[model samples]
Target: MNQDAIEVRGLTKRFGRRTAVEDLSFGVARGSIVGLLGPNGAGKSTTLRAIVGLLRPTAGDCLIDGAPFSALENPATHVGVHMDGFGFETGITARRHLEIIRLAAGAPPGRVDEVLEEVGLADDAGRRVKAFSTGMAQRLGLAAALIGSPRTLILDEPANGLDPDGIRWLRRFLRGFVERGGTVLVSSHQLAELEQVVDEVIVIKRRALFAGRLDDLIRNDVDSLESRYFDLVEGAQA
Candidate 1:
């Protein structure tokens, strides 16, 4: 039987009196790309953070490959995460930044250049991080994530700064990643772009509104993903 790559089980989080995520649960099957979709501040980030052990959830835990992220042996090799507020030292070159991560992951030294090229950042390897454009920075973040050779990637809004060409490249890259037996859980607001790549999608707003195959969510070809999403989200509004 195929194991789920990620499992968010009854995960709930609250800061003081404000509940961010409540009982948000879902699964990402191995070798698949799953989209985490929600309107702004719908606890997407909280769910992801809990999955990666970045913060302690108030009511639940997340499991990766059947183990909690903190419990996985050689955790970096099991999962790679790229999110907002990834602190990068502005003074270092992109190559140096990735080299540091690769070394820390105990990955082969040469993986740095290989991953940089994989993310289309080879030419900019020597450029200081401070000089990088938004898209370039996003690429650098991806390179850092892949440097560990993890089986799964958890990315939040990775396509935010990419131009159309770069977005297309990202779509192909993600598909190729899953084809190679890797898994991905990505959160992005670009529903149209996401519709092209994700096999399953988890839509949430402080709670899960939907979770299942993209086709099932759309119902039929006549209905669009965006239109269906609006209906779901709007219907949930109080």
Candidate 2:
């Protein structure tokens, strides 16, 4: 098992003349939760997509467990990625969605029940996903990510539509997940919310600006990550 759950070396992406990400390099240690902090259009989502092999980097590499992402046959077992705007079929119940993933992954039948309850979706298991509130759908997305018991989880703006209680549950759940030796990489605009759960954060403005311990990054001048984020981006603009 590699100590580094994720590694990106000189990763760069370009869409025509626009550079979404530039010379990005970072490592996420196993059993750690890393917050990818950036303003909108700062390449956070593009970086994530590159990590999961959804979008190939125009330059450099993204590795999972010491191997390139393209080398993995069953990427789902190695990585679970939950991006924004992914919705379930209207007719499928939450429980049934779990069943489908369980069957596809060949995971144990009990795993479905476990994660459903873990994400606070057990009560809504039988309810069709279309009827689920935004928070409930977010919970369901989390449950799906947990189904394969992936070693690494990548989530983008996961708290987008969640309520306070749901956000609290997610914070606790992610903390527990890392405690149990899982690696998590999350991107969110809710810097305050992330401050409550993240162990480390990678702050980027147009490109990689700061990558280090959360405390160290906030030391001296910046009082908090949110404050630091604004400072960094504004500084970049200036």
Best candidate (score: lDDT): 1
lDDT of 2 by residue, 1-238 (tens): 5568999999999999999999999999898899998887889988988887878889999999888878986766888778875568879899998899878777898999999888887888999998988888888888888888898999988887888887887898888988887899999989899887887899876578888788887787639888887877888852
How well is each residue in 49-138 modelled by candidate 1, as lDDT tens digits? 999998899987799989998899988889998999787999999999998888789899899989988999888899999999999999
What's the lDDT for candidate 2?
0.85
Question: What C-alpha lDDT do the candidate models reach, one value each?
Answer: 0.91, 0.85
Every model's Cα RMSD, please?
0.9, 1.8
Measured with C-alpha atoms, the lDDT of residue 214 in candidate 1 is 92
- Tell me the spans in candidate 2 whose CA falls farther than 4 Å from its real position: 220-222
Mark the regions of model 1 whose C-alpha exceeds 4 Å error after superposition: none
List clashing residue pairs in candidate 2: none
Q: Quick one: best TM-score, which candidate?
A: 1
